[model samples]
Target: MSDEFTDFHLEAGHAANGPYALDVDPQRAGWGYSSLRILDLPPGGHHSFATGDSEWIVLPLSGGCTVVAGTGTGTDTDGTFELTGRESVFSGVTDFAYVPRDTQVRIASGAGGRFALTGARCERRLPARYGPASAVPVELRGTGNCSRQVNNFGAAGTFACDRLIAVEVLTPGGNWSSYPPHKHDECRPGQESELEEIYYYEIAAAHGKEGVGYQRVTPSGHGRGTDVLAEVRSGDAVLIPDGWHGPSIATPGHAMYYLNVMAGPGETREWLICDHPDHGWIRDTWPDQPVDPRLPLYEAPAGDAR
Candidate 1:
């Protein structure tokens, strides 16, 4: 809605299909990076992309596919990357990897699948390559309340990059994530890290029915700010530049999945959020409760499209 980003609402899938969509030109959304889109695909069908000014990440949302990433800056021999999309990876959910700008990347599905992808202009300039495996792994620290796998961009300095740090989180149904209502929009080393953030979502289907998820971000009113409390199904996204956000409330029907893409002017991408001073005491309560039983590590038959 601002000059910072270019908006694309995108078309939704059929009720028989799953809720899946792609987001691009994050800067238009006030994001410092660029993005791409993903949905359903037919066998032998392929998508080719020319990297813009910023780098991009090429991840598969669902079903596996083959990709060729290279410096094919107008030529065909730059080289290609062959990857097998996850067999059980929900076909229309989750993200892949960060794609560097100016590179030529191509993707072809083995049997045609669906996916959700985001491409951001890379501030941390670096050379483009195919299948550059260099994301540092970090596990969620809290209890069963929510567990996730984080790609520590700050730790994995494999490429000379800047302006963005990305992380992927998976939450089981009924389980709560983004607990404690934390915010990392302000950069304050060891105290409060600052950075504008965006939440890109992909919820897994359950028992032949679609799954649902929600996210909330509210401003503290130190000045003129905004608050967002949205019911986000798969493919939908919410932007959060400044505020106290948390309790990524999930429904009891099914588990959820989402990818968080964040970036700020500062050099570090570490997250630092100040909780609602009144609710700051909740972090202590997590150790006592059991995570929601509906959360899914892997559910099949798929739910309805969001």
Candidate 2:
């Protein structure tokens, strides 16, 4: 039951517990690295947790909150950060807070909302920090139908963490993202990494209609045998401990969004990956096609911080 690839598919409400709407720890995932937690807070509600051996990022899926973080051994227990979150994950990029390992952090909100806690286990303890929405790099990738907007919020080299690498991706309705199926199940020195990955989805419902999407994961014959084909929706999730995964399809009527959390035991914090040979050639044709115009959805308002 704990096999990462065998227990890869998790429907909404399957992982719920307490204040956490969904919880996927490394042990449950069988990868021993990455994890994800979705917290639902009510008006004036709060939740607290110890970082322990993992570094975590507090990203608001909707609404705003205040974060107070401190280490048990440190004298300064007043480290507070205000995240001016937005209407929804589909509406705009949001501010976030990074909690270092072995520390304690508390989250309090005057208004209720859902938040994503993306994490990774690591031995190194980095400094607790806050990242503004303005600082997040927005990138549009692929071509035409394959086009998708990527928010490299906590991706490696962009944000400093001991082992965590998190990113948000938005795919337009009827489009395909995570294309050219890629695999990182091997540490090939300069080519690939052996990271474990988690995909948490949040599909956008339009015109009172519900949202739906699909995901696929096939075996890579490297670590574990894996095969999955799943219907994903808001609050749904999938784990990829090892395999060639990709081509996450957004249904015709729904725009899809997913938060990716990844981590590995490689010597360096890297995100190298190998694209599936059969589909890798698709990248070469991108130059001939036009980028999707529906991209860059909900750019943050020009302001101090939002």
Candidate 3:
């Protein structure tokens, strides 16, 4: 790949910084709003940081943790939440905690696990709160080979945030998710919203073998163009500054999961996208086809409100 594409693709361990196993901020991504960090803690380990100017959500990739949000003065406390995380990304929907901007946040895990700190620099500082796993809307999207499961825990309308919009997607092995390439690089009133996005991937292994997948991003001929075709593995990430990104395909025998973190300069925190015209017709075919049987790898926990 060329230097430009290579710059957007971060292999596992290439983006690690300090206590995070993978860290990508607006400054490092050459974008203005979105950021993501993956923290892997051993048993009985803890980590803390200040959420300066940006709102954040502590979503677990694996394992559970207790999150405490407080003022940096070491006196006043904002909130304390306990997350009942899952065994792994493919296991089930997990609860999370959100901390507002300009606060000090600490995370501690009794048994140790991996957590994702998805963030966005925004204008308002919302209150810190806990999100229950039962409240998340589990959606099965697309059909046949395009089938996938979506955990809309932090989607635009599902959960409220100032600017950050995050969600998780799972594609069964030999299937594709994020298909029919789309872009949100322009703020076109009711048509589309401009947003920068980050895709953090985790492919499930089988019998001591590592899994793999593919990601593609194409230029939209507007603003600063972005293009990439990356072979992704666990702990890898792709930064989409502006492009029609999609067709995230999982090779046979390995499931694929990705956490999508998005934010932008638009006045509204919406996820409206303009699909690639040539492939947009694919959506019309989904209505007549049967959804892949492997979909909904797991469902929302029992007693889900939605």
Model 2: residue 215 alpha-carbon error in angstroms: 0.3
lDDT of each: 0.56, 0.89, 0.92
Q: 1-306 in candidate 2: lDDT tens per residue?
A: 343334678999987767788888876777788989999999999999987789899999999999988844654433678999888988999999988887889999999788999999999877778888888889999989999999999998999889999999999999999998999999999999889999999999989988999999999998876678999999999988889999899998799999999999998999999999899999999999999899888664554532
TM-score of each: 0.74, 0.95, 0.95
> Residue 97 in candidate 1 has what lDDT?
45
lDDT of 3 by residue, 1-306 (tens): 322234889999999989999999887887799999999999999999999989999999999999999954444338888898999999999999999888999999999999999999998988888899988999999998999999999999999899999999999999988999999999999999999999999999988999999999999997668889999999999999898999899999999999999999999889999999999999999999999998789888876342
- TM-score winner between 1 and 3, please give it: 3
User: Which regions in candidate 3 have their CA more than 4 angstroms from the true location?
Assistant: 1-6, 72-77, 304-306
Is 1 or 2 the stronger prediction by lDDT? 2
* Worst 10-residue lDDT window, candidate 1: 8-17
Whole-model lDDT, candidate 2? 0.89
TM-score, candidate 2, is 0.95
